[model samples]
Target: MAHRSFLPSARAANVIIALGAFALGWAIYVRYALLEQSSVGLACRTLETLTCETRATVIALFSQSAFGIAALIGAILQLIRPSLIMFTLALMATCAGLVVYNNNLAGLAGGLLLISFARPWRGARG
Candidate 1:
């Protein structure tokens, strides 16, 4: 039998890295554009424009830690049954949640995702 590698394939790793980077970039944009205490945020609060509306919607979504909850759930699922899709979801949500004022749960989820890296493949035998 061929030896099973501990880590994912290089292509998978590349996809994960690229997607994670994109997620982080998008999260950073959201944090600065719609959530920070800058002139943009001030305009979002004071004006009645499309950008402000979008900002309000984003704020509403994160108000009750929706992103954090999603990340936590996704991470839990990923830990139970590791897969690229679940990993990607958890990773993206963790990045967004952490940047969008949902650090508590997001941090926990990130820890779980890290732990999941040690989990064996679904069909791997001892």
Candidate 2:
């Protein structure tokens, strides 16, 4: 009977998550501690040039709001369904972009990389 044969690899999952968390944390720390804060504004300015000033501002604002919502929702999902991990990851990507736009390459790179590798959805897959 296909009742239960293979249980998820809790050890592996935990290890992945731990490492991912560490990577993410270190990334953020490096950004704030090592890199000059002014880089953030430069990142934002770089985003601004891609489009017209007026529209760019609006898009940036909307993205910021979405980022918050996504993070909140993702957190809530943690209790009910681990699958939200992917949503959280996607949101993290959005946040990273904003960070980079704000001239924070460290945050953008580290934060995004953390979630992508972590894979919260792993356990929730079943």
Candidate 3:
């Protein structure tokens, strides 16, 4: 009999990755909505209900979503490979996301996951 590792299975890892991507996507969408609303200026007046307070709410939502996605992607990638490069990329993406809307997280996580899962790199030498 062989000893089995306790880490999450591939299916579980994929699910976590998908969730992180969704959070990132949602955050980007919220930011886009806020920007579009602000740029149009008087468009809010036509609605009669939109207000400055909503912008603050959207900003807060973006922050939380960004944090969740970053943390999830970072944690999951570390679990999958324990690579410093991957972790650094995740951290950078998360930090950059705070200042601007970017789709880097999805690409980074997706690429890392694909590479990590497509072939086992554990204990391989450069």
Candidate 4:
């Protein structure tokens, strides 16, 4: 068997890459007004309620998508790269999922499962 450590360390690199990707995704949605209008003005009475609900909707959408993507990527990366990078990516995705998914329990569960299992990098003790 090949001896390679996927331990979650080296503190890694390419985080900015992932961040940039996320930023790009957000920007694209904003620029294009792509997020559906279902949540907007769902309740016009009381400015505070409308604002809160709008924000919540956006967050829910973002989180749900983030979680699904993370799970998918984590699975693929587990087979493709070092564990550290995969773990880092999985962690980021989990955060996004936890923040945005409406049914947060499901999102959090999926994201955590991915993070918990990413292989450890070399010398990545703990």
Candidate 5:
């Protein structure tokens, strides 16, 4: 009798991918929503500073959006075909997003999925 490793199935992977998509969507939505509601607060506080408020806002927005987009793409690819490349990309994107936006929950979820999916287990072997 061979021992079986606890690995997620394709269905589980799909679920994880869906969750990642949701996270990506929420991140984008929330960031934009906040900006729209309180553009001044999100901008730089000092007017005399070298860095302009508008410039800071644009940079932050771009960084967050780019990270979310990359993660979303990676998640979509993983859903279509589970691969190490896709998993790594997704993990990296999620980490970057967390660093930029301080989104702990999304980062943890995405990281867990990527780590679990990357490993070779009984059910994941396809």
Candidate 6:
């Protein structure tokens, strides 16, 4: 039988790239436009508007390192059983976490994801 490589196909790579880029861009927008913007921050701290409420919610989640935690969990799962879904989840969460002040666990998750790439192909027979 012909050997099947574990590497992602071009289409899969494109999808991953697109999703990762979107996650990164969204995180940057939230960090700069919503969280760091003085007007937005002030409004969120004081006002009860819908935008401010949304900002507060995002702040609470990132403050608790939810994104990093999720990335780490996805990375660990991917390391244990390498799958495209888990890999994509970890990649997207890692990108978002790194940009949204969850760098510590997200960095660790990134390393774990890298290590997982070295794992033997799941379909390979010994």
**Model 6 clash number:** 0
Expressed as tens digits, the lDDT of each residue in 7-34 for candidate 2 is 2367655754665465456435434533
What are the candidates' C-alpha RMSDs? 3.1, 9.7, 8.3, 8.7, 9.7, 2.9
> What is candidate 6's TM-score against the reference?
0.87
TM-score of candidate 1 on Cα atoms, chains taken together? 0.83
* Predicted candidate 1 versus true structure: per-residue lDDT over 48-103, tens digit per residue: 99878777877887998999999999999988888888889899999989988899
Taking the tens digit of each residue's C-alpha lDDT, what string does model 4 give over 1-126?
Answer: 344444433234466356636844653453234234454435433456645565656656555565556545664665454465455555555444444442354354454445444544454444
Evaluate residue 113 in candidate 3 and report its C-alpha lDDT on the 0 to 100 scale.
43
Q: Using TM-score as the measure, which candidate wins?
A: 6
lDDT of 5 by residue, 35-118 (tens): 344554445454534435444664576556766566666765664555555665675577546644645543554655545444
Better of 2 and 5 by lDDT: 5
Q: Best candidate, lDDT-wise?
A: 6
Encode model 6's per-residue lDDT on 18-69: one tens digit a residue.
9999999999988898888898877666678887877888889998999999
Q: After superposition, how far is residue 62 of candidate 1 from its true place, in Å?
A: 1.4
Task: Indicate the residue-level lDDT of 41 in model 4.
Answer: 39
What ranges in model 4 sit over 4 Å off?
A: 10-60, 63-66, 102-126
Per-residue lDDT of model 3, residues 8-113, tens digit only: 4556556656654665665565566655566534665455445445655555655566643664477477657655455445544554354344345544554554
Count of backbone collisions in candidate 2? 6
> Per-model C-alpha lDDT, please?
0.83, 0.43, 0.52, 0.49, 0.55, 0.87
Error of 1 at 16 (Å): 1.0
Report how far off residue 43 is in candidate 4 (Å): 10
